[model samples]
Target: MAVVDGEGEAGLLELEDDEPLEDEPEESFDAEVPLAEEPESFGLASARASFR
Candidate 1:
């Protein structure tokens, strides 16, 4: 019973930690993936052509 109670408390703490991560994925998807990809694609092509 004591071990079960300790595990339950740890699970609740993990849930609290995870709540913020759930919010961050939205910005990560938008800023890291799409936002980064679009500029890199266009800028890299322009840079390559300019270099050659």
Candidate 2:
């Protein structure tokens, strides 16, 4: 089994601080990429197949 740890909590705080600066743009790109996959998984199988 995998062990869950407090390191993730620390990382969350760091992200909350970084969010005020360049994190917005960085997250936007990251969000967009996953968003694209999400739609493909939901109903756009054709697009997902193309990407693969």
Instruction: Report lDDT (Cα) of residue 51, candidate 1.
Output: 98
In terms of lDDT, the best-performing candidate is 1
Candidate 1 displacement at residue 28 in angstroms: 7.6
Candidate 2 lDDT: 0.73
Residue pairs in clash, model 2: none
TM-score of each: 0.35, 0.31
* Candidate 2 off by > 4 Å: 1-23, 44-52
Write candidate 2's Cα lDDT for 1-52 as tens digits.
2234856677667767775867479768987999788876777687677899
TM-score between model 2 and native: 0.31
**Local distance difference test, per candidate?**
0.79, 0.73
- Looking at model 1, the pairs that clash are none
Best by TM-score: 1
- Off-target runs (Cα >4 Å) in candidate 1 are 1-32
